[model samples]
Target: MNTSTPSRHRRATRHIRAVIQILSTAMLGILLLLNITPLLAYAQSETDVTELGVVKLANALEEGKITSVEAVQEYLDRIKAYDKKIGDKPGLNAIVTLNQHALEEAAELDKERASGHIRGPLHGIPVLVKDNINTADMPTSQGNQALATYQPKQDATAVQRLKYAGAIVLGKTNMAEFAMFWDTVSSVNGRTYNPYDPTKNINGSSGGTGAAIAASLAAIGLGTESCGSITDVSSFTNLVGFRPTVGLGSMAGVDYNPLGDAIGPLALSVEDAAMLLDVLAGTDPKDPWTSEADSHKSDSYLASLKGSTLKGARIGYVIAPFGGYDYSPGPESDGIFSTTEDAISVLEAQGATVVKIPLNRSWWNKYAPQNASFWATTGHENFFVRTEATWPKGLAELTEPKDAINFGDIVKGSPKMEKTAVEWVMGDDKQPRDEAGFTAAVNARHTFAQGVDELFTSYKLDALAYPTVAAPPAKVHENPGELLDSEQFGTHCGWANFTGRPVVSVPVGFADHFPVGLSMLGSQFGDVKLLGFAYNLEQAAPHRKTPELTPSLLHTAGSTGTTASSDPSTGSDEASSGNAPFTSSSGMSPSAVALSLAAVLAAAIVLISLFVRRRKK
Candidate 1:
């Protein structure tokens, strides 16, 4: 080989060779970064944006790895991408009216953070409130067209509390029209499809929240439960739902029976739910029911998450919760009832004792509340008049559940209102309501709850365990036929509602590719302790799978995170494969990252060229 070049050109040749080597190394580094850097950032930032539970999201925001605006924008992007109908079929349809000021609110929160004024863990976090909960900024439609234009005079007490903690109100979600049915069909927003499978029902009235949060449209959400709205919807979507003991929080601005409907959190994990409950559970002067909140509440529900485990816990397995059906949940199907039997080993592995309390259909049938009549709108005369007073004269109608929006106008406007809505609103409100029916219903609930308490005592149990839903959620429907008759929303959930006890529903596993949930019920105001126990089960066997249909919209070319897999390994704090651990690293756009690398390489080439020119000179 020719070893030597002319001495005159030798220095220039060496410089040119050095430039080639540098170019090669830099190109390789860029290629590596194109794969590694973007992925790492996506794995951390964009993935976290779309999939992180509230606790992780808050940490990221506080650490400055993610700005509130970025988080809010990511959610807005998801809603735009997946929250509408696609290919003639309904999409998640989770969100209704998005807060126009969401970005501004986020920017302000970011400013507050930069100025070193952190409100709390919820500071700068985005959340979706159920539409029925009044938001001063957005119309509180309550999922009815008549009230679609009705702007609330003030935020719901809960909304005010959330904002005070520096949480951004992302938007309101759809519900069963007037919250009268188990399915999330509304006159205004129409039907909310399950993100897990768009063909299925989301189980109202917090169904919109269920779909949105499941789809990662927001970090966490608020839900209202008159019966199984929170737990069942959460069950279908494979999220953790906490139905706080009635009066644990105020129901003042919510558009449902104050005596029956309780507002709660629907979140990705037990920790997030507890953190939200920490901010939300307190006394409100507007709600007389919440007078006992100060007395019964813990100092911080988030604190309850510390070092929680199932060790030394006793759980009662109530069998008859699913009554009067050909459905006998044995060791056969892998649904909640069946898989819950599988949880025994998981529970026992975590040092918990499980007892089977086999109360048959007869016992359950006997305790059923007679006047738990779905039609009765008892105790709502004041609410009706109040709503009618706010209604515009042009939209005048029968001043009945009356006040802000006239029911006559509501019925006429919502010509497509579900039959269940028609029956509950018109049949009861228009007719002579039996006031005693409500009283008897309340008394019956007391009797049922007392019996369950006795059962808990007999079993020496810390909590009573049952399926969140009696069966898997039914399909979405045009006719109210099977939707009304179905026990899919959970027949046993009323036991807690009537007795005013707390229940936390966690995703246990999947049956037939759908999530099956296990609910743990604690004594009234025993919410904190029950939460810890539920957290243990969640740790033992996490079944949180991000829905396939509504995946992260991180990039046009590829996916951000893999779907969550059920890790049957017990006693591990790690979430599934899809959920990456939280990190304090911000993400740059792919184009920005690419351009930055290009500029660096270009600078190196320029420097080499100058050296060669000097050598030649």
Candidate 2:
């Protein structure tokens, strides 16, 4: 029967099976390694859509290098990953409500692009709107718990324009409740931390937008400024903020002070801000204040961008605003002053004349007091009435405490609101609301406007430059309301608002780990010129730096994201970090690592297969 031969055959079969099993194990390992490579590379290739400026994103879309859906998804993923909470790192509570239909809208826009119908420069760009700005698709909570469910019937004029330009509404960002304070904290969303330093507060009422844009949660943001909300937040977050002349942009559908408020853009660069302004600046039938917008409008704000815009231009360095003589400097004064001086030097090198001018102390003292009184008394009453009338129907009828809907009730409901109310009342020396004071305040504004005109004429100045905030951003307080600055009116930003002049705040540099912004103030309706000058300075100095805490999550080829680079030539470090590709902690980007792993896996698989065949033969 040959039993020995049969046993030998069985042993031979077992050995062959064992070899096959070992080869299979090796192949699986190789396959796993190979799979990981592409995954890693794909991750590395994932673009941080946040870093792309409006124009750059538009160009990419036009070139079919990216899709609106991909861009929108990246922002959504970033928001989901870091908006509410990042890993151990303090979360930026920037967004209050994300547009549920963002992806769908983006898909539609992408389809439109495929059909050869481009909306505009902002087509398919995702933007964040300050919660205080009305949005039909999202609740206009104004970062107030009481108004948490309140949704507007229509979008704000600015939002409408953004949508008209094919810009996707990513979401509404948190803001000061009722747009009442400077710090971006509210009863609904808690507080938004500074992207650069979590311990510091993001100046509001546009603080959420500032933080969101700084963190790259959205491509650009829309902020409504009453006082220095826009500029202060921008200054603190190292962004470029534009506050147009009071009436240049519509205040319709936005909570604002008719005399002081304006809607503008907060962006990573001056050019992007200008592009937004180009779309947003126009006459609005709903906002009578914009009646003169057509006359004030330029052919194209984007066209005004030129390196030569600053050449032969006269810029006034208003020292008093930055604590030159009258006001004392804060602890961060040296750093602030140094960066400001450096900015001035950059302007000088750009062939612009920089003059040291003293702020009109006498004028500010005499009229500013009356204006303050008026703003607190008659001005407050007017704003309160208007806001009440325009408040969401649900908010307007709220009566939990029988008077919860009124401004006084809302103020008394919370200690923070009460404190802000006290400051507002005491700000004007507790002056009683009177027609005489109101008239006087109205006259003061006109007088201040005239004075601004006179100063520019006398100095032959193109713009007045000063620190956006008197000091660096104040540290965030345990009591969010405690972070509100009562002395904001004494700063340069308030003066610009009072006179209804257009102002642009550009990040100059970092001082004491906090960003310092330089503001350029121009005559009323001189927004185009202001933007042009800002563009020139931005190109020359380029001071905007991406916050370290909110670095890009993915590496992409030729991403024009800002980085901290020290270049002696520009006297600033806001430019690119050079042509070298970005790398992750692994020394290679995820994509590069994946490709290397893929090659290794292929070689390993080939070798294993060859060995197995040779052994089998």
Candidate 3:
């Protein structure tokens, strides 16, 4: 039950560093005489930490090159270095609250690793969760100032799955207020700037995860996508994002509109995403939507990655401006489109049959209006009225859980609410309701999903590919008073969301230094197959580059970090992606903690020197 704050952790690390400095200074003369620069061999580990992803970090832990404690502390240091305002510039502000007991949890995981009981692929990996997702130890503020101190009774279903898998819940990140905004601007934590370009806004509700993971603040993070929240920001920030079928992942304990909300991973690569999905994709008794999960989900999404290649695969590529909707402004559209075209050519070069799937302009024109009706007109009120509803009750001023959540009461409870969010609770209710229109919209959606399915069937396609986000990152000032980015020319998320299908986004390339992601969608319950295609694309065309804004910091296991990729993607089409070969059966008898300390002892002295330099600055 004992926990420690960041300051306390810092004091402890400082004490360790002080002892290291004294020992190192005394041994310096002897070490220098012998030219014992053991730490310098991997002195670049701290700087190269940006190069390591979730899978690589996991591999390091399994290999005894690092421990969960070192990895956790490394990310914490990165957060301290870059998350808040530092020097003359604005920081990412991605992290909303640090989990005080993260180090404690990580140390325990290390003990388990030492005891030879590995939980799963995520053992010891650090993750940043979106603030809207409930964590028992942290407040689930939903990015509203009024609910800033609102603590949930337990962790969300997805969070429980993560902890059970041995992942560290490092902290909570700021998110779009109520997961409703296009830009992640919260009244409690303000806006999260894109690390790709701090002046621009990465499209959100999942912006904090986008920025944090993009900047290497954590090994990976979780983000909820109602529509394009997960993929859009991931596209903007150059990270891989997956939005599984609506019911594939649980939404219980997460304050979301059940109509289209789903929880998924924002990670460095498709391999890592699939690994996380293995843990998250399952049926939850608390959520009725997940009833199909146990049936639909594969035994291991990672298994799908084995021997999966795009060669001889039928991939339907969207030749854009296809539906008379271009994804960017003027020349920028052509530039981004050109970038995507060049990347898509890799699909063919890798022996995949790339079939052009041009969407009809009329289909899109009618679909837009129908989509609006489906999202805006139905299910919201009733969904909130269900037993899962907790809005009004979460507000500090409104303690009665029995009270119905109303806009007027919500606005009254949080007087200093973000302006854009206030419209949700402060809007006039005098507008007429259209039951007939909603019914028609629902009918249209079914027909649309069926038609799209026929297209896949007719084409014999495994997945359909398109530009994830139509445009590059938008300037923070570009969309004033708007919930959706006004500058976006194209986005295909609604196609997957309304159809209840699986979709994923991976970095294709960069345009003028801004990241662009390619989206591939599959039929409902075909998440495993979809991931295989993405894995092929990821391995063949790895475009992920570390953000320049936030680099690295002094780390614990600097000497033990891997230079070559431990990525499972290195395997051939028929072989498993070499996923750290973890098992519950006993192997090494030596204590993992002892080995981790011994492995990094030489490096800790180097880290101390770096730490002192950082402090002086």
Where is model 1 more than 4 Å wrong at Cα?
Answer: 1-47, 86-89, 322-334, 369-376, 379-381, 387-393, 397-405, 430-433, 478-484, 487-490, 555-563, 566-617
Q: Write the per-residue lDDT of candidate 2 for residues 365-462, one digit (tens) a residue.
A: 65454324434253343433444333444444443334225544443334444355445533432123566766766776776667677778999998
- Better-scoring candidate (lDDT), 1 or 2: 1
TM-score of every candidate relative to the true structure:
0.81, 0.81, 0.78
Model 3 TM-score?
Answer: 0.78
Error (Å) of candidate 1 at residue 486 is: 3.6
Ranking by lDDT: 1, 2, 3
RMSD of each: 8.4, 6.2, 12.0
Per-residue alpha-carbon lDDT of model 3 for 1-617, expressed as tens digits? 65667666677668867788776675665445423322332232333346577878888888877777777766775676578964457789999999999878988999999999998789988999999888888887788776677667678999999989999999998888778767888777878888778777688889999999887788889999887889888888888999999898899888646467788999988988988899999999999999989998998998789877777889888744223443324665665677677668988888888888766656566554323455444234342344343343544235333355444445566655666677664552222335676566666667667767877999998888888876656678643334544554466677677688888999887776578888988878988888988888878877776665654333222222322222222232211111111111233211222233445656877777777667545
Whose TM-score is higher: candidate 1's or candidate 3's?
Answer: 1
Mind giving the per-residue lDDT tens digits that candidate 1 earns over 170-210? 99998887676778878787778887777677787799999
Give the Å shift of residue 611 in candidate 1: 24
**How big is the RMSD of model 3?**
12.0
* Model 3 misplaced stretches (Cα beyond 4 Å): 1-48, 319-329, 365-372, 376-405, 428-441, 478-484, 555-617
Model 2 stretches astray by more than 4 angstroms: 1-46, 322-326, 366-404, 408-438, 486-490, 556-564, 567-617
lDDT of 3: 0.72
Worst 10 residues of 1 by lDDT: 575-584
